[model samples]
Every structure is written in C-alpha cells, then in structure tokens.
Target chain A: MQFPSLEYLIFFPLAVAAWYAAAPRLRWAVLIGAGAAFLALASPTHFAFAFVLSLVNYFAGLALERWAETRKALWVLLATLAFDVGVLGLFKYGNAVLAGFAQLEALFGVAAPPRVLSLVLPLGISYYSFQLIGYLLEVYWGRQPAARHLGHFAATILFFPKLVAGPIERPHHFLAQLAAPKPFDPADVTAGLKLLGWGLFKKCVIADRIAFVIGPIFGHPRDFSGLPLAAAIALYTVQVYCDFSGYTDVALGSARVLGLELAPNFNHPFSARSVTDFWRRWHISLSSWTNDYIYRPLSMVISFHTSWRRVGTVFSILVTFGVLGLWHGATWNFVLFGLLHGAAVSVEALTSRARTRLLGRLPARVADRLNNVVTVVFYSLSCVLFRANSISDALYILGHAFVGIGHAAPIGAKRMFGRQYHILLLGLVFGALVLGRWWTRRRPVAARPTWQRWPVYYAVIAAIVILGLFQVNQFVYVQF
Target chain B: MTPEAILLEVNKVFAEVFGNPSITVGPTTTAKDVPEWDSLNHTALIAAVEKHFQIKFSLREVMRFQNVGDMCALVRAKTGG
Candidate 1:
C-alpha cells in the first residue's frame, strides 16, 4: 500500500501490532513479511524483481567483505558495479537506447528498424541500485563490515515505508537498528503520527491542488506564454517541493513509528543562496549520495597539480550533473535540467574568489539577501525543463515567460490565479505549516494542554476532509 | 611533527586551497566552519595537504576524516609525531 492511501491507512496499524507482538529474534521475519505484503499490494506482479535485486546485493556485500583486505576485491567491486549498473541500464534505458539506434539508422536514410520492445522499469530500480552500490562500497572500503544476517539485510532493503521511493537509506542507518531493535515506545509513535499528519496536509491541501492548475499549461506549454507561463514556473516550483518533500515526510514518519530514524531528505531548499547550497539543501540523500560516490571520486581522479586540473574538475561537475539529470529519466530534457544546475554551480565555483571580493564591497547582509532571491528565481526558471513536455516546449516557455510582463495580466494567468477557493486553501495550509512550525519551535505543541491540542488537531483533520483531493494519485517521485 | 605543528601546516593548506589567506583551523573545526569548505573544494584541499606533508591518504582514510582534528591526527601519525 502506498503512503496516504486508504489501504495503507488500514494496513499500518495491523503491521505495527504484528511487529510489536513478534518475538525479539523474529522481528526480522516480521519485517520481511510486512515488506513483502506491501510490495504485493503496491506492485503485485512486479514485486519479485526488487526482491531478486536485494538478494543479489546481499551476496555482493558478502563477496566484498571476503576480499576486503586484498586488491582482488576490486574485481568484485567492478563486477558489482557492472551487474547493478547493467541491470538498471537494461531495464530503465533499454527503450531509449533502441530509439537512439533507430534515429541513427534514419540519419543514413536506411529504413528505421521496427521496434517491438516494452520494459516497465523495475519499481525503485534507481533507488535500490544506489543503496546496493553504497552498501558494497562501504564494505569494500572497510567503513562498514558486511552484514552476517541475510534476513536483516533483506528487511532493510525491502522496508516498505521507503522502498517505493526513498530517502535512500544507508546500510549503517537502517541495518544497525535491526541489530538492536528498540522496544515499542509511545513517544516515538506520537511523533511519527504528528509527522504523518503534516505530510498529509502538504500532499492533499497543497501539492495535488496545484497540480491541477499547472497540468494544462505544461501539458500544452505553447498554448500561452507571458504571465501564465511565468506563473506556471512559480507554481510548479512549489508543486514539486510540496509533492516530493511531502512524500519524504510520510516515509520518515512511518520509519520513526517503527523505532527507526531515516535521514531527512529536504531542508527548506528554496532558502538556499546558491546552486551548490540548493543541491545540499534539496533531496539531501540523493545529492549527498552523488557527492560521495560520483563527484568525489571523479573530481579526485580529474584533479592533478596542473592548470588543467580545474578544467577537469569542471568537466566532472558537468558529467556528474548530466548523469544526475539522466537518472530522473532517459530524456534530453532532464539532462538539460541537470546541466543547467551544474553550469550554475560551476560558475559559482570558478568565480568564488571574484564573487567574494565583489560581495565584500557590499553590506554582507544585503549581499546575502540578494543572493537568496536570485537563486530561487533562477531555480524556478530552470524548472521549466523539469516540467515541460520536451526541450522545444521548455525553450519556448522560457523565451516567452516575460514577453508581456509589463502589460496587463493575461486572461489565462488571471483565471489560474483566480481559483480563489483553491488559492485560499493553499494559503491557509501554507500559513498553518509555516506559522505552526514557528510556534512549535518557540513552544512545543505536545507540552501544550489537551484543551489546546484537541482544537488544533480538529482544525487540521477538518481541513484535510474539506481540502484534501482524495484519490490514489502516486507521489511525484515514484515515477523516478 | 607535533599535533600543534601539524595543525599550523594544515591551516596553511586550507588557506592555499580555498584562497582565504586569513583562514585558521583548530582541532574542533569541521567543514561547516567555512562556507567555502564544500565537496567541490574538498578534494583540492586534500591534495594540497598531502602535497604539503609528502604523504598520501587512501580512499578509506580520506572518507573517514570528519574534521580538521581527524586530518591532523592522521598527518601526525603518518609523519611520526
């Protein structure tokens, strides 16, 4: 069952009960059962693929540990990378590869090959593959010893709360908990429930609500431009943030309820002052994963004590981002989105000294303020590619986003913004999230009296009932 | 090299890598202490430190380093403190 689904709403409590009721040594079995049940319900027919991959990674980790002290381990490491990356490439990008060959044939005026291939990327292939790779790398590097228990490894990988999409749980974080399972704690459950409520509000009251407004525009981006397109850019930035972050909160909250902690995946990313800062703040798990595994290794290899070192470093940035973008989908648009970000980050890096000297001339506070606004606006603009149907559509939208900005607001823009009730719903929820968080930070909500808690809780529940777009829409990140 | 002597050399390495001549690094100083001390510059910083000390760090040794203190400790160990 997916997070926020009615089925999940029923399934969760039963799983919790079964988990706590199980004997201490049998907890792993209980978790695996729960995880398998979840996969069956979520992707009944295709669930075995993920389970198989998990087993493959389990063996890979053991092999790496066996050769941990010898260079022969490098062969195992290479084999693991090849196997994991090969499987992902075959399933996830096989179609795109075929399409490329067909286009090449067409270029020489040969008859394009008839293509009869269909592949549904195994659920969470991109995510689990990375986890497996990370796990193997840690073992090979001697940072983490290989897991002796197969059941613990399997449960960690198949953990239903994070399997579909992920905060990309590390072996250390998830598996360590399995070894020293926590007793059922009421406090953790309460905190987890609170997190779930916040996630629900974000999804139903905000993300899904805005999805409707921007759907038609991105669907046929060339239909209109000017303020409507500009507004779409702004709205979409919000839409994706709410959708992805909303899903992560639910995932983390669910894990917490089970007495495990998942690393946070977001941190008010829009507040970042630069593209590098933005990457660090947004999708923290993915960004940090790439930083450690992709960027660090590449940059280290590329950098030498020569003038070309910087050029090689910048090239790594481009390639890493290109790969990051492609990881979203095997499409040109995602590549562009990643490179756009990579380019910005590269420029920021190359100009660090000049930028520092230039900014030093201005008031430090004002310079910081200006950078924040500039970063958000630039990111919003780049998201045109993230949401657009194709490269041409995104470019068209960008070309005309500000074409008639000084003129009166266009009718389409007016109508989109004039969804008064929806706007009100968005505003209310956004205010509640921001202000409630602020207030809670100053004064903890749980410490407050029952009289106060009941009303606030009722208002939230009523808001969900009244404002929620109740349906079984998958989270945005689930597509990746 | 003593730990204190190693820290002074490491501080010089940071200054050269980040181009912040006034930079100072203490035992407790983590990457968070300097905004410029991000992943992008981290490799260069490591290379510079290794060059200055004529010592090499393995991938594991590099990954395990948490702060300036860890780097200094490794440097002292390698340079026979």
Candidate 2:
C-alpha cells in the first residue's frame, strides 16, 4: 500500500507497536518480515525478487570484502554488478526494447503479432539497485565493512518505509543504525510526526490538488496554447517537487518514528544559485550517488588517461547526465531532460571563472539575485520537458505557450483555475513554507521539538484531512 | 618519503595547479577549503599530482581521498621513497 493510503495508516501504527515490543536482537527480523509482507501485499513477485536480491547482495558484500584487492574481488564485483544491473536494465528498458522491435517489424512490413512483450518494473528497483552497487563498492574500497548480519543487511535495503521509494540508503549510514537500533525516544516520534504532517500538507494539500487542475492541459498539450499551457507548465514544477519531496519526508519521518534516521533526499532546491547548485540540492541522494559512483570515477579516469582533459570532463558530464536522464525513463523527453541539464552545467563550468570576474563588478547581492532567477527559470522550463507525454508534446507546449502573445483569455483562466481559488491561497502558504524551509529544518524536528510550535503542526495535519484532495494520483516518483 | 614530506610536495602541486602560490594546505584541507579549486578541477589537480609523483592511482584510491592528508598518505605509500 502507498504511504498515504488508509491501509498504510492502519498498518504503520500496529507495526510501530510490534517493533518496540520485539526484543532488540530480533528487531531486524521484525523489519524484514514487515517489509516482506508489505511488498508481498503490493506484489508477491516483487517481494520474492527483492528477497532474492537482498540475499545475493548480502553474500556479495561479504564475499567482496573477503577477497578485497584480489582478482577474486574483481570477479565478485563484476558478478553482482551484472546481476543487479542486468535485471534492473531488463525491466527498466523492457518497454523501449519492445517498441524498437515493433518499429523495425513495421519497417520490414512483417506482421509482428500484437507486440505484447512487457515487464512490470518493481518499485524502487533503480533505488535499491544503486544502493546495492554502492554498498558493494564501499566494501570493496574498504570505506566500510561488509555487513555481518544477514537480517540487518536485508532490513537496511528492504525496510518497508523505504522499500517502495527511497532516500536510497548508503550502507555506511543506514547499516550502522540497523546494526545497533537506537533506544526508543519520544523526540524521534515528535520529529517524525512533524515531518509526516508537513509532507502530507505538501502532497495531499498542494501537489495532488494542482494535478487535477492541470490534468487535461498536460494530457493533451495540442488542445490549448498561450497562457493556459504556460501556467500549467509552471504549476507542474511546483506539483512534482511537492509530490516527490513530500514522499521523501513521509519515508524519512516513518523511519525516524521507528528509531532510525534515513538520509534526506532534498534540500531547498529552488534556493540554488546555479544549475550545478540546483543538482546539488535536487534529489540530493540520487545526485550525490551519480556524482560519487558515476561522474567522478568516469571523469577522473577519462582525465587521467586522455590527452584532452577538458574535453573529457565535458564528455563525462554529458554521458553521466545522459545516464541520469535515461534512468528516469526510456523516453526521448527524459533523454533531453538529462542532456539539457548536463549541457547547462557544462556551460556554467566552462564560463564560471570569466562569469565570476564579470559579475564581480556588479553588486554582490544583484549577482546573487540574478543567478537565482536564471537558475529557477531554467529548471521551470525544463519541467515542461519532464512532464510532457512525449518529446513532440513537450516541444509543442514549449513552442505554443507564448504563441498568442497579446490575447487575454479569461475563459482559459477559468477552466485552468476552475473555482479553486482557495488552492491558490494554499500555494501561497506552501511558498511561505518553502521560503522558511531553511529555518524550519534547522530548529524544529530537534529533540522533543519546540512545544510552542505544536499548534501549527496540528493545524497542517488537520487541514490535510479536511482540505486534501485524496486519491488524486499516486506519488509521481512512485513508479520510478 | 614521509607523509609530512609528501604533504609539502602536495602543497606545492596545489599552488601550481590552482595558480595561487600563497595556498597552503593542512591535513584537514579539503576541496571546500581550496576555493580556487573545486570538484570541477579536482581530477586535473589529481592528474598533476600523479605526474609530479610519477605514480598512478587506482579509481578506488581516487574515490577514497577525502582531504589533503589522504592524498599525502597515498602518495607516500605509492612512491615508497
């Protein structure tokens, strides 16, 4: 069941009770059992697959450590990489592969019977696969020891809270806590509940509500143009951030309530000053993962081995982002999304020194303000590419959003907002929350929390139930 | 070479690569501390170090370097002078 669902609401409390009641030594088993049941309830095939993966990687991490720096180390690393990446790639790209075959058969005028090959990619496959690879690499590098307890290792990756979507646990981070689960603390619960409440505010109250308003405009971009299209595109950026980061907060909060801390997945991404800085803040776990495991190694090797180091760095940026984009989906739009960011960051890198010197002449605050606006606008438009159904649709929305330049259309505005003026007020409050995020994160959610602020929390949680548009859609990142 | 001695060598390489002769790095000096050099030029700096020391570092060694101290230790171990 989804984190915000009624079933999960009932299940979470009972699981938390069972967790604390269980003996400390058996806590790992309790987590794994709960996670297994959760995944099995969602899809038994996925549960079985995740169980097998956890077992394989548990042994793989151990074996790699045992044979570290030997030829055997290479073999173990390659084997696990093959297994994890192979299966992940098969499901992740399975539809794209079938689509290619269908196109080829059409070209040849051969009747390919109904093009029925499809694979259901398990939820969090990309997340866990990356985590597994990172875990093995860390053990292989001696950054951390291979986890000794099989149950703890499984629990670390498959914990029910993170099993479906993730903050993508690092072995050194999550495994340490699982190895020695913390004693029960009311502070953890308070902090967790606070995050849970705010996340629901963002998800149910803002993102889901907005998704309905913009549904048809995105569903068929060809239908409308000008302001309606432009507005929908802008709203999409807000919707997605709320949906995904909202999902992350719930995941992290749930884990916190259970007496473990998961790594945070987002910062105030909109506060970033550059495209590069934007990546540093957005989907922080995934960005850092790609940086540490993919980008750095690839760029370093390319720079070290090649005569053209600068060229290699650019190439690596493109390739790394291409992989990042492809990771989102096998669609051309996603590919463009990755390359667009990659290329933008590359331009920023190459011109940064000169740009810094040029901007130095300007007042520092002006330069800072300019950078923030430029960065936000870049990602805001990129949101058009990300949410569109296909590349052509994205291009159409982008081309036509400003086409009818001087025309004022109240009817278009009416259909777009559609008597949901209150939602606009909610958006304003969310904007305030986003503006105060730096403050909120720093002070509240600490040990026991600030009791004075409890009412605000209660109001948000209460508002979610009262005003939230439930069942609007699944969390946008859930399928990924 | 001792790690301390290698740290001196690394300091020189940092100055040359970053083109800032005044730069001096302690054990705790990280990429953040060296404002002139960030992750963008990190590999280039590393390549300079490899050339100066006349020793190659594995990808694992590159990934593990957290600070100037880690770089010095790796250099000392690699050069074995």
Candidate 3:
C-alpha cells in the first residue's frame, strides 16, 4: 500500500501495537507475518519472488562462507549474483525487451513479438536484490559471516516498512540489530513518530505539492520557455529529494519504533558542495555499495593496466558512473545522466588541486562559499539528465535552461504557482527544509533551552497535522 | 627496505596528499580521524603508499584495512621486514 493510503495509516499502527503486545522473542515472527500479509496485499503473486530471492541470497552467502578454497567461494558468489541478476532482468526488463522486439518486427514488416507472460515487479526487488548481492560478495570476501538463522535473514529482506522502499541496510548493521531483544523505549518511539510526521510533511506538503508544477512542465517541455522549465527543474530537484528522503525517514522511523536501527539515507544532499559530496550524502547506501563493489575493483584493474598517476583515474570514473547509471534503469536517459555525472566528477578530480591552488590566496570562508556555488550549479545541471523523461527532453531542457536565460516568459505568477499557491507553498516548504537544516547545523544545540526546543516541536507537529488533513502523497523512490 | 625508512617515506606521501603540516600519524590512525581521507583520497593515498613503499596491495587488502596501522603491518608482512 502507498505510504499515504488510509490502509497503510491503519495497518502501521495496528502492526506496531500487535508487535509490542507480543513477547520480545516473538516480535520478529509478528513482523514477518504482518509483513507477509502486507506484501500479499500489494501483489500476492510477486511475494513468492521476494521469498525465493531472499532464500537464494541466504544460501549463496552460506556457500561462500563454507567453501574452504577462495576459488570455490568466488565461483559460488558469481553464480549467486548471476541468478539474482537473472531474476531482476526477467521481471524488471522483460517487458521492455519484448516491446523492443515488437518494434523491430513492425519496422521490418515481419511477425509481431510474442506476447509473453507479463509479471508485476515485486516490491523492493531493486533494493533487496542489491543488498543480497552485496551480502554474498561480502561473505565471499570474508567481510561478514553467513547469517545462520533463516527467519532473521527473511525478516531482513521482508521487513514491512522498508520492504517497499529502503535505506538499504547492510547485513552487518541490520542483522546485528535483528539479533537484539526489542526494548520498549518511550523516547525512541517518540523520536521515531516525530520523524515519521516530518517525513509525511516532506512527501505530502512539499514533494506532492511541487509535483503539480513539475509534472506539467515535463509533460510539455516544448511549450514552456527557460523560466518555467527552470522553475520546474528546480522544483523537481526538491520534489525528488523530499520524496526519496521522506520515504527513508519513515522507513528508518518505523524500524526505530520496532527497536531496529536502520541507517540514515539522505543528509541534506542539496547542500552538498560537489558531485562527489552529493553522492556521499544522497542515497548513501547505494553510493557506498557502488564504491565498495564497482569503483574500487574497477579502479584497481585500471591502475594495474596503466600507472596510477596516468590513465586509471579517468577510466575508472567513466566506467563506475556508467555502471551506476545502468543500475538505475535500462533507459538511455539514465545512461546519459550517469555519464554527465561521471564526466563532471572526473573533471572535478583532475582540476581540484589546481583550482585549490588558485583559490588558496582567498580567505577560507570566501573560498568555501565560491566552491559551494560552483558545485551546486554543476550538480543541478547534471540533474537535468536525471529528471527529464528522455535524452532528447534532457537536451531540450539544457538548451533552454542556458539559452532561455535572456528572455523571461510571459507566464503569470499565479499560474506558475499552480492553483492554490502551490509554487509559493513548495518554495516555502523547500526554503524551510534547507533553512532548518542549515540552522540546526549552524547552531549549537546545547546552548538552546528546552523553552526554545518546545516551540519548534509544536510548530512541526502543527505543520504535519495541517498537511495530513489536506492531502498525502507517495514517496518518489518507491518506484526504484 | 628498513621498516622505519619505509614508514618515513609513506608518512611523507600521506602528508603531501592529505595537505597536513603536522599529521603525526600512528598505525592506529584511520580515515575516520582524517578530514580529507574519503574514498577518492583513500585511493590516492593507497597509490602514494604503494609508490613510496614499492609494494602493491591486493584488492582484498585494500578493502579490508581498518586503519593506518593495518596498512603498515600488511605492507611490512608483504615486504618481509
């Protein structure tokens, strides 16, 4: 069920209540059972796929650990990864492949592509699959042990809150939490509930509200000039962050309420001062996974083939980002998005020292501010590729974003805001998010009294109640 | 190479790459303690260490090192000093 759905609203509280009512030893059983029921509700047919995927990874990890010889472990690990990738390909990309074949047939005036059994994507396939792969690889490399308990491993993959979307917990961090007994910590629960409310505010009040404008602009990019399109792009940047980060907060909060500590996913990514820093803050789990598995290994190969001081760095960046892009989806747009980021980062890597040298004469704060501006602009431009539906659309937006600068469009402020001042609302919400994060980061918390804290808490609660009463929206990252 | 001499050269490389004047690193020091010691910097640091020590780190070793001490001990083990 969607996070905003009445079904989820009812189900979440009921699940939490039932979970705590059960003995500590049986809490996991309650969660798994409820999570299974929820999965069945979402897509009963695909629930089996998740089960099988988890089983495969669990055994694969065991095999990797048990094998005495490194070569045997390596073989088992590769075989397991292949199987997981095969399952993902079949369910996720099967339709696209069939459609491509059909298009080819029509172009040739030949027979049409056969109608294959279309399978619905199981919830959390992309996330769990990646986690499974990382788990097996880690075990094979002796980074972590194989999880002995099948039930615990199953819960790791199927936990309801993050089952649909995730912060993508590593086996080491997540499994350890799973082994601990559930404690009824009122403070943790309170913090978790507050985090959940804040997440909902981001999704419903900020992201969904912004989507009203962003959706229209993307739909008809040709009609909108530089100003509207740029506005849409800016709004989209916020929308995506809120939607994804909002989902993570809820996921983490839910897990927190259950006495499980999930990792924080987003860290005010927009405030990142470089593409590399952006990756570090945004979708941290995925980025770290890519770094450990893809970039490091690939870099080693590149370094071996050529001297470390020479060709390896550029090659590694391009290849790493290319793989990263492909991982997001099969679309050409994602590929270009990855390449643009890769190129930007490679350029950043190459010139950082020289740039630092040139800027070294400036005051430290001044240099930092200048660096921040340059990085944000660069990162935003790259995001044009990410937000656009197609490569052509991306090119069009970039072309206009650059060329449409001199001439302002004739669109009214009211219309631009959408009906009910959504643009203004989106701006205010986004401004509040950035400003609050900045304020929190800048201010010393110990200096603030409880009197200062209570007002902020009340204001946040009021905002959530206000937003929830009016509307709710699905998080963006659930699709991935 | 003597372990002490190898360490001195490696220390020099670390100081240069990290741009720290008085790093005073011990074997126990780690990336977590160093501001500039992120993934990209880690890779550069490894390369610099390799050049200075004349020893190559396997992928497993590179990935597994927990601290500067681990790296130093590993390097020493490989070099048989």
Candidate 4:
C-alpha cells in the first residue's frame, strides 16, 4: 500500500498493535504473517513471486553453506545468482526487450512474433533479488553463515517496510537483527514517530508541492525558456531527494518503532562538495553495494590486465556506474545518466591532487564555496538526463538552459503554491531548505531537549497541514 | 614473516603507492586513519603489497581486510611465517 493512503494509515497501526501484542517468540510469525498479508493485499502475483524466490534462496543459501570451500559451492553460488538475475530480467526488462524486437522487425520488414506471456513486475523484485544475491555471495565466500531458520530468512527478504523501496539491507546486518528481535521501547517509539512525521512533511509538503511545477516544465521542455527550465531542473533535484529520502526516513522510523534497525540510505547529499563526495552521501546503501560487489571486484580484475592502476580504476568506475544506471530501468536515458556520473566521478578521482593543490592556494571558505557550486551545477545538469523524456529532449533542454538568461519572465509560483499563498509558500520552502541543512549538521533531532525540539516539530506539522498536497504520488524510487 | 616484518614491508608499499614518503602504518591502522587511502588508491596499495610480498590475495581476502592488522595476519599466514 502507498504510505500516505488511508488504507496504509489503518493497516500500519493494526499491524504494529498485533505485532506487539504477540509473545516475543511469536513476533517473527507476526512479522511474517503481516508481510504476507501486505503482499497479498497489494498483489497476489507479487506475493507468489516473493514467496517462490524466498524459498529458492533459502535452500540455495543452505546448499552453499553445506558445500562451502568446494567446487560445488561455487556452482551453487553462481546458479543462485543466475536465477535471481534471470527472474529480475524477465520481469523488469521483458516488455522492453519485446518492444525493441518489434522495432527491429519493422526495420528489417520481417513478420512480428506472436505475443509472449505478459509479465507483471513483482514489487520489490529488484531490491530483494539483490539482497538474496548478496546473501548467497556472502555464504559462498564464508563472510556470513547461511541462515538456519527458514522463517527468519524469508522475513529478511520480504520485510514489508523496506521491501517496496530499500536501503537494501545486507545479510550480515539485517539477519543479526532478526535473530534477536527487541521488545518495544518507549523512547524508540517516540523517536520513530518524530522521524516518521518529518518524513511525511518532506514528502507531502516539499516534494509534492514542487512536483506541480516540475511536471509541466519537464513534460514540455520546448515551451519554456532559460530560467523556467533551470528552475524545473533544480526543483526536480530537490523533489527527488525529498521523495526518496522521505520514503527512507519513514521506512527506517517504522522499523525502529518495531525495534529493528534498517541501514541508512541518504546522508545530506546536497552538502557534498564534489561528485565523489556526492556518491558517498547520496543513496548510500546502493552505492556501497555496487562498490563492494561490482566495482571492487571489477577493479581487481582490471588491475591484472593494466599496468596503470588509474586507468583500471577509471574503467571500473564507468562500467560499475553504467550497470548501476541500467539498474534504474531498461532505458537509454538511464544508461546515459549513469555514464555521466561515472565520467564525472572518474574526472574527480583523476584530478584530486590537482584540485587539492588549487584549493590550497585559495582561502578555505572560497575553495569550499567554489567546490560546492561546481558539484551542485554538475549534478543538476546530469539530472536533466535522469528527468527528461529522452536523451534528445535532455540535450535540447541543456543546450537552451543558459541561452536566454535574464531575458525571460520569472517562472511564476502560482501553480505550485496557489495564487494567494505563493510568496508565503516560497518563503517557507526556502526557509525549510536552509533549516534542513542546519538541522542535519546537528545531532539527531530526537536527542534534542523537548523545549528546543517541540516548536520545530509543531512547525513542521503545521506546515504540512497547511501546505501538503496529500496526493497519492508514489515515491520516484519505487519504480526502480 | 612476522607481523612486524610484514608491517615494515606494508608501510613501504603504502608510502610508494600513496606517494607520501613520511607515511607509516601499524597493525591497527585503518583506511579512515589515512587521508590519501581512498578506494582508487586502495587497489594500488593491495597490488603493491602483493608484488612486494610475492603473495596474491583472493578477492574475498582482499575485501575482508578491515585494518592493517588483518592484512599483516594474512600476509604472515600466506608466507608461512
């Protein structure tokens, strides 16, 4: 169910209540049942898909553990990984491949093939598949033991909170929490509620409001001129951050309320001063996963072939990010998005020493501001590919972004904030952005004195109530 | 093959790979402890160590090293010290 919907509003409280009411030993059963119910409620097809994959991976993990240190274990690991990737490919890319084949047939004047079985993408397939693949690899490499309990293993893959869109919990971290579920703590509950509220405010107030303006400009980029286009791109950058990170906050907070800890995903990414630093902070879990599983191993292999280590590192970064981009979807634009980032990161790595030397010559504050501006502009421009309808469209917009600067009319804020409250809303958004940066720099808000924190909390709640769109817009990351 | 002996070689590799002659690493030193020891430089350091010590590390072995101490232990074990 969508996070902001009435159904989820009712379902979450009931699920939480039932979970706590159960005996500690049976809590796992409660979680498993709840997860199954959620999947079934969402889609029986998704429920079947998740269940089958979980069962397959469960046995695969055991077999890998049983045959560890043998050639058989290697085969088991490869087989399980293939199955996971195969399932993901068939469900996620099956339609895209079909469409591509149709275009090829038209080009060659060949008869089209008959219709294939239509596939519905199982929710969380990309995320859970990666989790299972990581689990199998860990077991094969003897990094972590295969989970003995089938229920816990299934729960790890199908846990409802993070299943939809993830911080992509690793086996080592997530399984440990499942092994010993904690009892309800009042402080945990309070902290979780605060985080949940903040996340909701970000989603409903900031992201959804921004989407109203972003939709038209990006949808018809040819119609708008320089400033409006730039504003759309910049707003899109903020909107995506709020939407995805807002989802993560709610997921983490909900898990915390249940006394489980999910891995953190975002880390104030906009504060990053360089492209490399941006990757370090943004979508932290996914980047780390790719770093460990894809980039590091690929770099090692590349190192065997190349004498110049920098070339190998740069090549590996590009390939790894290319794959990461493809992970977003089976689209050419996504591929470009990933490659752009890859190139940017490679440049940053290659020029680190030179950049450091240059920065050393400047004042610290000047250097910091310059770096931040460069990073932000580079990333915002790259996101043009991410948000555009096609690569050509993205290029057109990028080509025109700075063309008519200072000559165009201000992109009015009426559609985004309503005619009466445009100025007020704009001021609030700007204020929130500034305060968000300052707040993140401090300790966790939950840890602050109530006298200091309550006012901020109430203000956020009030803002959300006054300005929230309350539309059922799925988070941008969910499609991935 | 002793930890101390391996660490001396490791320290040299670190200095050469990172281009900092003053650099020194002990058993407990981690990546975070060194300013220049980022992901790109890390692979180079591993390669330099392997070439110097005449021991190749498995991918898992390379990934599992948490600190210089772990690397020293692996080197010692592989060299049959």
- In terms of lDDT, the best-performing candidate is 2
Taking all chains together, each candidate's TM-score versus the true structure is 0.92, 0.93, 0.89, 0.93
The candidate that achieves the highest DockQ relative to the unseen native structure: 2
lDDT of 3 at A385: 78
Using lDDT as the yardstick, the better of models 1 and 2 is: 2
C-alpha root-mean-square deviation, candidate 2: 2.8
Per-residue C-alpha lDDT of model 4 across residues A1-480, encoded as one tens digit per residue: 777667778878888898789887667677778788877888888878888998999899899889877889888888888899999999888888888888888899988775565877899888888888877877776778889988888888888888889988896687788777788899888888778887888898888877765676677777666777777788888888899999999889888888889999988788789988899899888888888788887898777666868889999999989988999999999999999899999998899889899899999999998998999889888989998999988997898878767223334333333533643585678887788769868686657898977887898888778877775578888889
Worst 10 residues of 2 chain B by lDDT: B31-40
Error of 4 at A88 (Å): 0.5
Which digits, one per residue and each the tens of the lDDT, describe model 1 over residues A61-87? Answer: 888888777878888889878999998
For model 3, residues A1-480, the per-residue Cα lDDT tens digits are 877677888998899898889887666677778778788997786578888888988888888888834788878877888999888888777877777888888889988547775577778888888888888877776767899988788878888888877777786677777788668888778778868877777777777877766675776576666676776777677778778888788788877777778877888776777788788888898888888888877777666556764367777778888877876776777788888888878887888779779899999888877877887777667777777888788888878865645333444333444345665665676678778778789674335688977777777767766754233345667766
* Residue lDDT tens for model 2, A1-480: 887789889989988998999988889888988888888887888888888888999999889888888999989999999999989988898778788898999999988776654678887788888899889888887778998998888888888888777887786798788778888999999889878877888899888877887887888777677887888888899999999999999999999899998888888899899999999899988888888788888999887678788788889889888988888888888889999999998999889879999999999999999999999989989988899998888898899998775232454554555546755766776676786666667665343355746666666877788878787699888777
**DockQ score of candidate 1?**
0.47
Higher-ranked by TM-score: 2 or 3: 2
Task: Provide chain B's TM-score, model 3.
Answer: 0.85
DockQ of candidate 2 against the true complex: 0.72
* TM-score pick, better of 1 and 3: 1
In candidate 2, which residue pairs get closer than 3 Å at backbone N, Cα or C atoms, i.e. clash?
B1-B81
